[model samples]
Target: MEETLHWQPAATHTELLAGPVAEAVRALADDDVHVAAIDPGLADTAAFCEKYGVALDESANCVIVAGKRGGEVRYAACMVLATMRADVNGVIRKRLDVRKSSFAPMAEAVELTGMEYGGITPLGLPADWPILVDSNVASHNRVVIGSGVRRSKLAVSGALLAGLKGAEVLDLATGA
Candidate 1:
């Protein structure tokens, strides 16, 4: 799958990424991270993998979840393989210590992360938001994820993602 796409150094192709995502790539300064341009209309996981010949398990999805308690709301990014769903109502709700937790609205997620709706990635999320990585994803050798823009995707080592500043690898996936 990696050889199927024309991969370029993410740090050098900032134009293909949303502002915050590009900045995050630059900050990481990791040469192994790569990016590939894709048709914006096919950015969704199913379409992308089918069109690009990538396997479902090789791609990770980043879901933005909002947890609310009283009048306070907190947001977090959950990274799980496309083959599994995040344990939102169970693990995440308890982790956030919130009474109610659900996927954040599209508009709220886009606005808060400064990333496009289908292109939100854990790499550049707000520093305060904890990035919950599914243990399966964290153990994978490589995985593709959104690049903060629908027109491109980032390819990175699972280990690198798990090592991000605020990332926490956990048993956050179910139905695998």
Candidate 2:
């Protein structure tokens, strides 16, 4: 866990999390998963890392992407280290079997995931959404990620995240 934030069992700090995130944490019941409060104003990845003295590689970002084919839409979440970028147009598009893919619109992402923009995490996404985790992120011992709210973050092992339902570990990222 990052030293700048006070870490505690995520199961014990549901109040700091968004509704779906809290529910997910309780359901997970994993003691190793932790949470920490932070300044909501610094929720964006770069700002959060710089203000808290955490390295970009020690944090992960969850991105919502929408793929469309034949007028139908498929949505997925891609998890990648902050130092990398999800290959939405290539990897994700092919994975979703869609003709094209791109980052989901902020309004649609927030509404669909029931999370705030800049603070959405894969933990509490819609059950139907596939979670694509970058290989580098899935190999980390611990990484900070959103708690579905701008005011807090979750600390979890990559193994735990990889074990999540609908999670698929793959080469989903490109160099930043």
Candidate 3:
């Protein structure tokens, strides 16, 4: 699912991105992506949308999940529309092939991803980690996602996100 989207220069909001995220944005050099700074305190999707005048339907949430197998923990990031929630115990656990899966602790998510708790994005995730994008999310023309920090958000084409390495767009979301 691909659609044309309007994007601008992400470099304009470099100050809002975390170190790794900023570097990743520069590396991509996507003219079809843009970043905008906002109050870190309002980084949460609902607040960010309300405060910044962005529609909730156009905002995506990146949630880190911890899957355990034989005492070893593996992580995956799930991207879904703010209007829905990921099917973690069902679709995700099955996809990950793990015994069980749960949302990663805030500390662990931030530490491992080198991003803020309320601002984790799929863009700069570890290469080994999978980025599960819900089908509906992949079909959106444009979406607002975290910038690896709470102070900013990235506006990008849904097709661009689905194209990221290790990204798998599937039916991973359910009604909230």
The TM-scores, one per candidate, come to: 0.97, 0.97, 0.92
Residue-level lDDT tens digits of model 1 in 67-166: 8888899998999999999999999988888988999999999999999989999988899999999999999999999999999999999999999999
Model 3 TM: 0.92
Cα displacement (angstroms), candidate 2, residue 142, comes to 0.2
**Under the 3 Å rule for N, CA and C atoms, how many clashes does model 2 have?**
0
1 against 3, candidate with superior TM-score: 1
Could you tell me which residue pairs clash in candidate 3?
none
Q: Write the per-residue lDDT of candidate 2 for residues 1-176, one digit (tens) a residue.
A: 34388999999989989999999999999999899999999999999999888899999999999988899899999999999999988889999999989999999999999999989999989999999999899999999999999999999999988989999999999999
Question: Candidate 2 at residue 37, lDDT?
Answer: 94
Extract clashing residue pairs from model 1.
none
Off by over 4 Å in 1: 1-3
In model 3, where do residues sit more than 4 Å from their true spots? 1-8
Q: Which candidate order results from sorting by TM-score in descending order? A: 2, 1, 3
Model 2 TM-score relative to the real fold: 0.97
